[model samples]
Target chain A: MASTIAEKIFASHLRDTPTPGDAVLDIDVVMCHEITTPIAITDLMEKGMDRVFDPDKIKAVIDHVTPSKDSKTATQAKILRDWARRHNIKDFFDVGNNGVCHALFPEKGFIRPGYTVIMGDSHTCTHGAFGAFAAGIGTTDLEVGILKGVCAFKEPVTMRVDITGTLPVGVYAKDVILHIIKKITVNGATNKVMEFAGPIVDRMSMESRMTLCNMAIEAGGTCGICMPDRTTAEYLWPFIDDKYESVDDAVKDFKQWHSDPDAHYDSTITIDVSDLVPQATFGFKPDEVKDITDIEGENVDQIYIGSCTNGRIEDLRAAAKVLKGRKISRNVRGILSPATPSIFNQALEEGIIKIFMDAGFCVTNPTCGACLGMSTGVLAEGEVCASTTNRNFNGRMGKGGMVHLMSPLSAAAASIAGHITDPRKYLQ
Target chain B: MKQFGGPAIFLDRNDINTDEIIPAKYLTENSKTALKPFILEDLHLEGFDPQSDELKNAGVIVTRANFGCGSSREHAVWVFEVNDINVVIAESFARIFRQNMFNCGMLAVELPKEDIDIILSMGNVDIDIDVTNGVITAKGAGEKTFNFTLNDFARELIQAGGWLAYADKKY
Candidate 1:
């Protein structure tokens, strides 16, 4: 049968031969972070199911509200700390060693092609950039996954989104994804896998692909996937080096997870990015996107450039390129997080942190805090922000505060302009 | 089956996300019940007051499409469950929120747009849901009955008092 990559992965994980409807498939990785994992940890402990399927396959981090924002958050982290210690989970990452779980786990080569991963956090779909069937699940599913190493899902259906055409200068992967979400509306891909393909996806760096897939949930997609290829093999090569002779050999083996040319899709759509420009959101929803020109010059009180969505090295480089030898507008409070300690150290070593600090931006340790308004860089009432994070839901940054979602480059440019500004101007 | 229905709180907008449903600020709370008073506290829907008697007294929520759209936190569902809002009938729900509802032994009823329109037209009517029969009845003024669909797995979850119990029995 001609199967899409998502279907192939799902079928491969099932204990029995694939069935037509709801199938229980084994979970390869159960990623957890402090805020949500503690709830599951509490529940599992209460129910006498305080056991992990495999400690080696479990990865935990304390990225959200790190350094113990409050007593509650501190306790949450401590619970995860004790639980990981009790289980002898070697991959557990606490504050200083932690980054955002989505960015940190993949950086550690914890995810691979054809794996089925679940995490209580929604952005867990970020790992699907590696050609895995990764979905953000709820607490109950998280508990079941931790205990039994399996999860239930309906038979797979896919929507093939072929993003073709040349990406314009200053229009990065964040813009491309924002464009796609605006075209498809939020919930356009509900209950289905979003298969991102075409030349554009093929050319994207693995970081760019992760940025693209990270917001799959914003579009109500169960998972967003790119077929594993040379880029994927190269990104994972350091960890899988002994298993494969070379990157080419690893790429050849990954071909088993690719979709057949004739695979069935519930729907097919194509997005041409040739004329695309830098995009930013206008309202509470992720789909409320507008071209930068349409909303430029709206004064922004804050500018934040980080999150699992666009907080990697590439994102920092893009933002730094615009911020070099420039100062942020006096009215704007700029904040930058590098996603992980490794990315943080790399940014410092590359002088990116110096560029940001000199540009009057506050560089914080890697944490998912400010992105969700849990800590650091939270907005006051009636404030407006230009952010690189995913959701811009009303009060997402803070109650009565407005957030305009944009790319890292655009966010950095907005910090200079003190409002929403086009990043292409800086590039030129 | 755990049957439930109540006076419906009409949040007439779309894309009611988890953040608005429970807010990220309260995510650190120790227990789900601590989330009760804060349900829909951050949602800025027209004519919807989170603290109003209409909201506090609501047993069901009839909202527009793509409800519970952001953040996979089950706290959104827990907030509703803690508030005794056992049912949310909408045009559609974000995938994870729907599953989370069933995992909590709650009902997230997705009706067709036309059916939703009919229900909304009934004004502030109370509702009664029959889980086994999959029927929703509007009580008082615009008295009407509508059939909704719940997939087999979701029904089983609700029947088994959520995923944990189901796992205990099967796994």
Candidate 2:
């Protein structure tokens, strides 16, 4: 079988043929947030597996409930903290510095080009931006992965998404993904490996690439990846000093991951973003998206500008620019949460956060807060919202809290206007 | 106490997402107690207040398109089932949510928005789901009938009473 890129990553990680099903892949990096680790640690303890199967490969952070607002969140934090101390997790980050887990994991150089990475969080697909095959695993899967230090898998069929031409001005990476979801629906990518190609994807920043891969799960793909090049090296170099592996090794382990010039796909969808605007969800599905311009008078009570998707500095910058010198309207609650502690610190240094807070936005410490509807950002039964998070399912944020998923820029714009508004008004 | 498919309750809201179903925070430690309280909390802001006697009054939730969207957290399905909500009548459903529900033997029934609206506005009406007939009939309100798409696996799960119920037999 002519191995695909997904196969390459799997082969590179494969240790000696261990079991009938369990193939040990050389872990390039491991990622975790609070929720998955406590149980993993507990499982280990129950099994009397005191030490981790591997520590240097571990990167644990507390972002799911970083601020620890509720009793449950607080309990989760202490559990993670104690786990970090006991395991001596090298990349452990405390709450205040913790932003979103996936955002921080890559921003901090936990991912490298031509590497195989795993994260306990479902959004682990976010790491694919660095040219790694990353996917979020369930708790049982992660616990097993940590115990034996490898994961099992069947191969994913390759699917290519060709997004050509320049994406519109206000149309950031989020829109491209939303547009793809609109085409592919939610289950369109189910069980397929999507390698985003076309010159347009190459032009996108690593952060933008992260945004694309992050939402791959929304479409039900195991993970979405972009093959690494010089851009991958530039981003990886600053984040790590280690011999973070070489491209030659990458080429050796698996064939360079690209669709065969005439490669076949289970399905191939083309997205045209040149005319698309910043998109948002109108209801309980990421696929339930519409152009921001379409929802003119909808009453949105909340506007959330964070999550693994749009919780980066670029997201913050876009939101800040929209709300610059203006306050969120009284009828609207502008909620912002940065993705990582490093991203938050950088935002602070750049005064991006000041712009957001000064604009009357209620910012939460880095956690997957309202984006998941467990935070202060949830809406009332009849309230509407404009958010930058993935998914818009019923009761997603809080039942009766209607979600209108959009880009960070649109979210910020909607926050200021108290309704869904096009981000192009500010970005242009 | 009933397995009747119709007598739907309209929670006619748009964009009911999964994050709101079981927030990522609760996914931290897989415990029954942690998930039970927060059910549909994001769906309604108060979270799902089980103490409020929600489980006793089982009713159908009629929602807009793309209901139960996002994340494959079975917690979302369990929360609803434990709360006495067996039927999710939506114009559409996220594929994952449907799968999760089907695996657990929950009902994810879809119909046109117009039929859903008619039942909601008419109030307290009963309906019979005739799977073999490929139709759902409103109790007495002008004899409205609706069509739905029921996949084989989904039908099997619901017939089995949810994924746990199904797993018991399959395993």
Candidate 3:
């Protein structure tokens, strides 16, 4: 049978021919963050194994509760730092040095095409934008990877999602994904790998592709991956090591990282986004997304424009375009957090930060921040927010606080209007 | 590990995500004890406090589809373990949540929808798990037997007291 991208990647790491079942595969990279790493370390220590299998393959970052919100979290970060240093792990990124693990992993070039990556983070699938097969594992499974350098998996069936037609003006990649999730339902793709393809995907920027792959878990998918193309290669060129003769050479090297033309898939879903509108979630689940026009005048007390989902420079630029020269509603509080320090620096250089600051927005440091309800900008009881973060499960932002997920454009527009409003007018 | 029986608590809702199982606020604290009070606290199930005696005493939890759907936090599973919830029989489970259960040496069985409904109807009845035979038996009025599925790999991991113990023995 022709191999899907996931099958091709998994088979490359094993000596035996790949079958559609459980098998232990070697991992190219193992990533973890503050929230999950300490637990894995504790498990390793409890097992009386003090050393990691390979420090080189492990990437640890303090992102979730960075700057140490409280004494408890500070102690947890201390334990991770101590453990990484004791093991001489070279890829450890301390607070302020690293942003979110998912964004930083790609920004630092730790993820490459056709690699099998595992992390103790559900959004680990975000790395799949580079044409890699990545998925999240629990802390104990991460402990197993740390000790054995390999993790077991029950081969997931592939669900081919093909997007056609150019996205309409004012609609972003976030809308496309939210639309797909709404169609697929929250549990539609459970235990499956979603292989995104077609004309629209072929034309999407790297950041947009990352946005799509990042939320695959929201629909209960194990992972979502796109085959690497020239666009992917171009986005990765700058991050490639100096060993490559040129960007063209780097692209040439990634030629082997794609699914076969005849790759087999369990199911196929096709969506045309030519008439797509900006989408926003009206309820707790991402699948509750509706077109921006359908949700006009829904009031909100806050608006957030960042997270691993929509915190890229492109997302910032989109929100900046909407917020430029416009004052936000006095009744609303707005925050714009970049996904990584690199993106934050780029935004500053481009004056995106100036636009946000002049618009009465609180431009915070890059961290999971308010997305996980951990630190700064957490929602208060009875408050409603229009946000660009991925999950909107009840109390995701804070106790009794509600969130409506949307694209950065829509979120910024909502901040201006103090309600969930369409961004098309602002875009025009 | 063969036959074990305990009182079962039925949660009829579907898509009971990890956020509902254990919210992100409680995730900052690593202690299993600190997590007990918050287990299923977000569910707002009428007359059921996660800390109340009624829920604290139940050893098995029966629920509908997609139990533990969001976030890869093992704390969702840890909350159950700390609260003495040894087994969770759901119609389906999110992949990561299911694996976390096995990693903690807790049993997460996927039963047919009809069987889950039958199990729920037998409220407060003792449900016995037969790991070796892959059977679930309810010891109450109209005692019923239902078959469940467990791969050998997961069973072995549970037998060895979770992934940590299994890894120690392997590596």
Candidate 4:
């Protein structure tokens, strides 16, 4: 039978022919962060296991709540550092050198086409942009992956999301994804793999594609994947090892990674982005989205443009384009955090940091800061923030905080307006 | 993983995410005791607190669709386990949250929407679950039995006291 990309990846890893919902022992990479790794390492130690199955396959990063917000977090980081050193883990990225785990891992060539990656962070699905099968697992499962080098997975049904039209000038991948999440409720794609296809996906940059896949969990999807194409090969070429002579060779090697023409999907949904407007979440859930123009003016106290979802260099450039000559409203405290150190350095070289600073934005080091309400730029009670992050759950930024999820352009526009506004108005 | 009975507390809300179950603020602590008082504290349900006398005494929780959505934090399930919540019945659950529950040997039963509504209407009812038969019996007003679904692997994991114990035996 013809198989979807997800099925193909699963079957390649399995010894037997794969079927939907079949448990398979396939995991290429296991990753965790400061928040979740301490528990998994402690569990491993308690089990009398002194070393991980393979230290090379394990990736540990200190991204979330990094720089030690409190004594508890500091101790947790210490535990992880001690465990990584003891295990001789080669891929450990400490607090200062670390970015968001999801973004940094892919840039370091840890994720590749047709590989099955598992991480303790839900945004591990972000790696699926490179045509890999990546899903979030709990700390216990992470421990299992570390010990056994393989974790069990119940195959997920595939949902084909075909975007048929070109995105408008001001609209972004964030808008397209938020629009889809609104059409499909929070639980609409529960336990399914979302396979993105059609023209819009083909034209999207790697960073934008990552932005789309990063929030697949928001709609309850196990993973979100796109076919490996020239763009994917080109984006990974620089970071990839010396094995591949050229980008064309890498693309040629993964030629079979695409879904079969006759592949059977459980369901198919078509979305046209031609007339789609820039979107922003009006409520707590990411699905509660509205067209930027439809939302009335609501004062915002903060504006954040960074996360695994929208902290890439492209996102920084988009926000910087809007804030170049203008200052953010005095009532609003704006923040810009790049997704990785490389992206941060690129932004600094491109003078995006200077533009943000000129616009009165507080530029912070790369972290999952303020996105999970863990540390840095937390909101006070009843305060409102326009963020480029994926989730807008209640108090996601801080206690009693109201979050409006939007594209970086929209976030920058809101920062200048002190209220939700259309980015197209500020775009050159 | 056999027969078990407990008082059921109704959380009449949908999409009860992990952040609300145990907010990110409390995730720094690794101890169950440190996370106990804050169970469902951030949920901010009208007139409901997981630590209240009414909830503290209850062992089963019934909720609406997509319970335990958002974030892969298993601390959400750990918080419930520490609070003595043995089972969670919902119309539906986020995939990661359900797996997290099973990994910890806690029961997360999925009932039909109508059955969940019926259970929620009955205040402070005792629920008897038969894991082998996948049935939930509510002892209130009149005896009502509802059929639920549990995959075979999950049932085995629960019987063996979660993934760690199951792994111990299998590996």
Candidate 5:
């Protein structure tokens, strides 16, 4: 019988029923924030379910309102901390040691390719960057995972997004994703697993790959994944046990991208970066976008180049290099947050941190930070922000604050201009 | 189940996401009953309110197109059920919300998109869905026929009022 890369990995972990994708496969990793855990634990207790299926498989992080601003959100954070201990949940990544759950979990090795992971955030597809099948769920679903150690999911139609050829000199992975969203529009992937394959994808770094999969859900997909390869194993080797080897074996064994040749998809979208340049989202919706050079006089009040979308060390460096010899405009508050502690350390070693701080930008510790309205660097009411995070909903970052999503390069340029400006105009 | 008036106050539309049905914050309740106040809250906080004159007179709703489009919050259905809205009429529904509503006794009524607009535009006008003839009769709106089709299980569940009631009788 033939199986997709995700099905093969899920089949390996099934101990009881091996009925393909319909069966509830065992979960290798689980994550819950403070907000959801309080209720999930309550449900498990009412059902007389004692002891989590495996506390070690879960990570409870205080990301939603980290650095809890006032006494109210702080009170909620404390409840999360107490519940973490009561449930004996392990991997409770704390303040200063954590960023967004999506970015930090994979960086720390809880996720490996060819594995099935379930978390409480829809963007859990972020784990797919490592070649794993991860999706988000609700509180009740998390409760089921905590007790049964499995999640019920159907096999999604496989979509092979073949992106080959070279990207223009100034373009980065962010531009590639924005280009895909534009062609497909929103709700394009309804219920499918998008496997990004091709020469360009293989050459992209793990951090860049994560950024792509992270936005897959915006198109209404179940999840998005890439095939595990040599780079996949290298990234996992440090934090995971050496005994748990060959992380990419299943993906490579099956040649991950082969789609049954006859396998059909409900939809398809191709992106050719031959003439692409730095891009940004112009309006409230992600698909409402523009090339950096297209718009004039769009004022930017804040510039943030961080979050699960573009919060890697490379993303920081790309922006920091632009901010090197200059300062952030007086009225603008430029935020440079690395996605993980390890990435933060790497930036420090590479002098990226010095460049960012010397530019008069505020260097925040790792966190999702206002990316999903979780509150780390929220703009005041009516403030206009040019950010590298996903989503710019009406009140996503505070009441009435206008959000403009952009690539890291564009955000840095906007920081220098104190308004939404193009990077090509500022670059050497 | 949040209120006695609705097995579910049906709405029209398919692909109704959790984001459109309810704002994201209410999904974490340990008790599913807490979700009763948020249905259709996304369209207008007032429309889903029990006190809203437009909705108070009608006990159920049905819609066309993607009924609930974003987020998988079960609260979306709960809010509708709480507002006394019962029997969702739509051509299709989001996969997650449909499954959740079925588990809670919210009958998901499937029909074509054109039929749904007839029912919605004629608000407060109750229609008798002739399942056999695949027709809906909207009072003065003159034979605003519809095609009400349902899987055997969903049909049985709605007939029984909800899952708990269905299970109580069948199991």
Candidate 6:
């Protein structure tokens, strides 16, 4: 019987053949961060099950409200720190060393093809780009995963999305995903895996693929996966270097995880992006998107360029290309956070950091701040922001504040104009 | 099998996300009770005031599709649990939110759109959930009752009073 990648991974992990109802499958990685992991730790302690399945497989990081925002957030970090120490979890990343979990974990080569991963945060789906079965879970499931090295999931079903056309200039992966989300609405992929295939995805860089899969949850998808090819193998080559003779060997092994041509799908969608342009969200929901021309000139009080979704090194390069010498509008406050310390260091080495600062952008240490309104550049009441982060939900940045989700290139253009503007103008 | 239901607070909107159910700022609170007062604090539905007494006393919620659609935080369900709202009947629910509800020994009833239309028509009615029989009855004119189904695993989790108990027994 042929199977989709999701089904193949589930079958490999489960003790028996996978079925329709719930099945307990072994977990390969259990990711924990400060805010949500603390609650799970406290719960486990109360239940007297304060132990982990495998210390090495458990990666803990404090990135959400890092450097300790307040006593409350400080306490949350402290709990995670103590818990990591208790478990001898050497993979724990603390202040000055931590970045957003999604970006940091993948950068460290922690995720791989055909692995099963779970995290307490929704963006865990970002790892699905590696051809893994990754999903977000609640604290109860988190506790069970930590304790038993297992998680229960419904039988896997997949929705195949075929992108047939080349991405027009000025359109990034973020805009492509925003376009897909707009086409599907927010809940269209609910209860199913979204498998992105076809030429466009096949040509995307690993960074771009992560960006595409990161927003799978925004569309209510359990995961968004790309077939593991030579690009995927090269990205994971450094970590798996010892296991294979060459990248081609690794790709050959990964080909087994691909869905067979006759594999079943719940639904299939074909999107042609030959004429796609830069996109921006208009309202609270992510699906409320519009062509940049339709929403341009909407004045923004802030321009934020960072988050697990668009905080990687490539994202920085894209924004820097547009902001090299241009100063931001006086009315707009520009903030840029590279997703990881290594990315920050790379930007500094390449003079990208100087370009942003000279353009009046505030370059901060790696942290997932301001995206969720926890700290560092939060908007005031009634303020509007052009952001590279995911989710434009009302008050996502701060109470009564509005956010327009767009690509880093678009965000850079908006910073210069102090409004939602097209990045193509700056590219020219 | 157990029974849970009471006055239903209806919000006829789709994609009622976790951020609206409980804002992200409250996730740092030490206990689940700290989330109670802020339940639906950021929710922006017409004619629904966050400070309304009706919300405070309501024991159930009847809403449109995709209830709890954002964020993987379990706090969304905790807010409802702390406020004694043990059940939420909706057209459909996001996968993780529905599972979280069952993990906390609460119920998330998924009814079809047509049946949901009938229940939403009964304005401000009290509801009673018979978990064993998979039934929800609205105490209003016509006294209509709706049927919902739960998978055997969900029923087991509810009976065991959550995953921890179930794990204790099975693991």
TM-score for every candidate vs. truth? 0.98, 0.75, 0.97, 0.97, 0.84, 0.99
* Candidate 3 chain B: worst-modelled 10 consecutive residues by lDDT: B44-53
TM-score of the A chain in candidate 5: the value is: 0.91
Model 2 chain A is weakest, by summed lDDT over 10 consecutive residues, at: A16-25
Computed on C-alpha atoms, the DockQ of candidate 4 is 0.60
Off by over 4 Å in 6: A16-20
Cand. 6 TM to true fold: 0.99
Q: Give a tens-digit lDDT track for model 3, residues B73-142.
A: 9999998888878899999999999999988888999998998887777656788888988988887676
A180-280: candidate 2 lDDT, tens digit per residue = 98878776776667788777898888888989999988876768888676567667665543554764444443336543456456666677677777777
Report the Cα lDDT for residue A158, model 3. Answer: 92
Question: Which residue runs does candidate 3 get wrong by more than 4 Å?
Answer: A15-20, A241-244, B44-48
Error of 1 at B30 (Å): 1.7
Once superposed on the true structure, which residue ranges of model 5 sit more than 4 Å away at CA?
A10-23, A70-72, A244-268, B1-52, B55-64, B70-111, B126-171
lDDT of 1: 0.91
User: Which residue runs of candidate 1 sit more than 4 Å off their true CA positions?
Assistant: A16-20
Better of 2 and 5 by lDDT: 2
List the lowest-lDDT window of 10 residues for candidate 1 chain B. B162-171
- Go through the candidates in order and give each one's DockQ: 0.69, 0.15, 0.64, 0.60, 0.21, 0.69
Docking quality of model 2: it rates as incorrect
| Candidate 1 residue-wise lDDT at A377 | 90
Off by over 4 Å in 2: A15-26, A239-264, B1-30, B33-69, B72-171
How does the DockQ of candidate 2 come out? 0.15
Global lDDT scores for all candidate models: 0.91, 0.70, 0.86, 0.87, 0.68, 0.92
- Candidate 2's displacement at residue B152, Å, is 21
Judging by lDDT, tell me the better candidate of 1 and 5: 1
How would you encode candidate 4's per-residue C-alpha lDDT over A1-428 as one tens digit per residue? Answer: 88899988988877322234646465788887989878888877877865687888889988988788889999999998998899899899997789988888988988899998998888888999999999998887887788877666777589999998878888999999999999998898889999999999998898999999998899999999999988998888877648788888888887787899999998999999999999999988888889989995877999999999999999999999899999999888999989889999999999999999999998898999899898878999999999999889987888899999999999999999989998898876
Report the C-alpha lDDT of model 1 over A42-101, residue by residue, as the tens digit. 998987889998999999999898889679999999999999999999999987799999
* Root-mean-square deviation of Cα positions for candidate 5 versus the true structure, in angstroms: 4.7
- Residue by residue across B37-145, what tens digits does model 1's lDDT show? 8988888777667889988898999989999988999999998888889999999999899889887888999888888888788788999998898999987676999
Determine which window of 10 residues in candidate 6 chain A has minimal summed lDDT: A15-24
Candidate 6 CAPRI grade: medium
